[model samples]
Target: MLELRLAQGNLLKKVLEPIKDLVNDANFDCTPTCLSLQGHTPMAFVVLSLRAEGFEHYKCDRNISMGMNLTYMAKMLKCADNDDIITIKADDDESDKVHFVFENPNQSKISDLEMNLMDIDSERLGIPEGEHHATVRMPSAEFSRICKDLSSIGDTVEISVTEEGLKFSTTGEFASANIICKHNTKVEKAEEATIIEMNKAVSLPFALRYMNSFIKATPLSNTVTISLSSEFPLMVQYDIAEMGYIRFYLASKIEEAEYEQ
Candidate 1:
């Protein structure tokens, strides 16, 4: 048996909203220590890890993988109030359905939902731990705004990180725009500051549509971390307070010259 209770039920709702469009179904791997989901679309891959300690109550008799349709799960979660307490349960041996229970703070309302598990076959990708060429930490809202603004100018945004700062640029048929964020550790709040760590300068173009989708997780964290390397996929991560983190990995677009070669 596996059970987990979360006081802030809205966290699950916020987590699902960003990735439901990108992935149709996913496996939620439950263990004694954590509940994690890993899925990928053609353009992006995502991982959500929620630690057990963050939950109000967490119990696991055995490890289990519960496959679920994210769209349906999101809808069910929508039925819950933002302040409700959410309890999820599944029997490790005989359970074909995962159960969700929601209770309001005043105990005036309670709701329960049962969703059937799926037999989905997915291979988990092993994420390497190598250092990236550059890493930029900035406010989540700032990143979202940059992606939204750049999308209006072009289909793709070129991201460049240097000692000076981080740059987002795009060129449309009629106009071009550049937005640069200079490194600054001094701020009123640490989360509001933009910090950059660069071992080497890196620049690459990525699909703005996907980047915009990734930023849908902006509400989950006050700040977002972006790691970039010329040879690897760009990683955008949002830490969920004391719980865990949601990370989105997007491959850089190949330039016409590189594709031709």
Candidate 2:
């Protein structure tokens, strides 16, 4: 048997939104203390992960890997009100269908649905969060605007991070643009401004599409951390209060010749 519960449906909706964009189906690796997911985008350029700990109202009855269709589940989840307590139930390890129940204590409202599951093969990647040469922790809302603004002019954005601060830039055939954010900006609260550390400066180009997609996670967190190094992939993480966190990793774009001589 497998069961999971959350205090509210909207919280569950927010928890799963970022993953639905990149993955249609996934296996929820459920344990007594946590429920986590690990998967890559269709092209494998970006790796997305979600980690939720079983604390407070969150609970896990028994360890089980529940294969689910996230898209259909998301659709069904919309029927739930923000204050509705959401409960997920599965009969056993071999259960093909899972049940979702939403109840509102104030209004005495109830909604329920059952969805069929699939046999999904899940692979967990060994992505280590090693010491980064350059790490930038900035307000997520600001980062989202920068990505959205630059994406209109170009498909790729260049990130340059140094001990001083961070720079976001992009260029097209006719124009070039750059936005510089210094480490000590008075416009931001001491805790909200850009914080950076580096041994050597690092600049790399990443697809704006992927970045814009990542920015969708802003609703889940107030701050986002960007860890960069020449030897490792770019990592962006958003911590969801006490629940856990969602992380997105995008490999730096490398241009190559069409034919080798």
Candidate 3:
């Protein structure tokens, strides 16, 4: 028997939207301290995983690998009776605890909460495991601005990094954008004493998707940190709230177009 209430329903709604693109009919791991799920986008080219843990008193470590279609769930919640507590129920012989809760003040449709337990042993999501070339901290606001500006120029963004500074630029289409942080920028907090170098760029589309997913969970901030390399995934971190943070790893989208001589 578990009962919990959240003040804001939009938070959960927003969290589920982007994830809905990646979460299919898959099993989710639910433990006493957390409820998490990680699934690959059908063919496993892209993966999405989420964990909501340590919010309240929790017990047990039961793995709830139940296949609940996220699209169905999202639609259900959209029209669910926003009553109050989103209750989750658990049955006997409880290998995993299942409970029910309410949305705002309405009741969620019974048909929308269906789930199935299947064999979910292997994990599909994996992070880059390699030595990074450069690591630096900046403001999330600034980073977000760069992404927005680069996106304005074209569908692709080129990130150039060097020991002196970091450059964000875009071209090739009917638009153009560029931003240079020469060792220090007032809009961002740079640690000049450290080894922060870059001379590379990745696609703005991929970066936008990955970065938006990471920073979407919390309030926008002025400070962010990043770790990057020419051949490794870029690591972006943002302080969402007082003590909460969201980190994202975006794979480098290397361009294959040859420049005309």
Candidate with maximal lDDT? 1
Error at 241, model 2, angstroms? 0.5
Candidate 2: Cα lDDT at 254: 53
lDDT of 3 at 125: 61
lDDT of 2 by residue, 1-261 (tens): 666677646777876777787778888777766777776773233343334453335456677777888899899999888788888878875478888988886757877788888889866777856777888888999899999999888988999996657999999777888998887546446548777778789998888888877887898888899988777778898887776778888777653111121
- Against the true structure, whose TM-score is highest? 1
Candidate 1 C-alpha lDDT tens digits along 1-261: 888999999999989988896899999999899999999976589999999999999998778999999999998998998999999988766578999999999989889889999999998888756889999999999999999988988998999998768999999999999999999989999999999999999999998988988999999999999999987789999999899999999888873335446
Count of clashing residue pairs in every prediction:
0, 0, 31
Superposed Cα deviation of residue 16, candidate 3 (Å): 2.3
Candidate 3 wrong stretches, greater than 4 Å: 1-9, 22-26, 41-53, 59-61, 79-85, 90-100, 103-124, 182-224, 238-247, 255-261
Model 1: residues >4 Å from true position, as ranges? Answer: 255-261
Give every collision pair in model 2. Answer: none
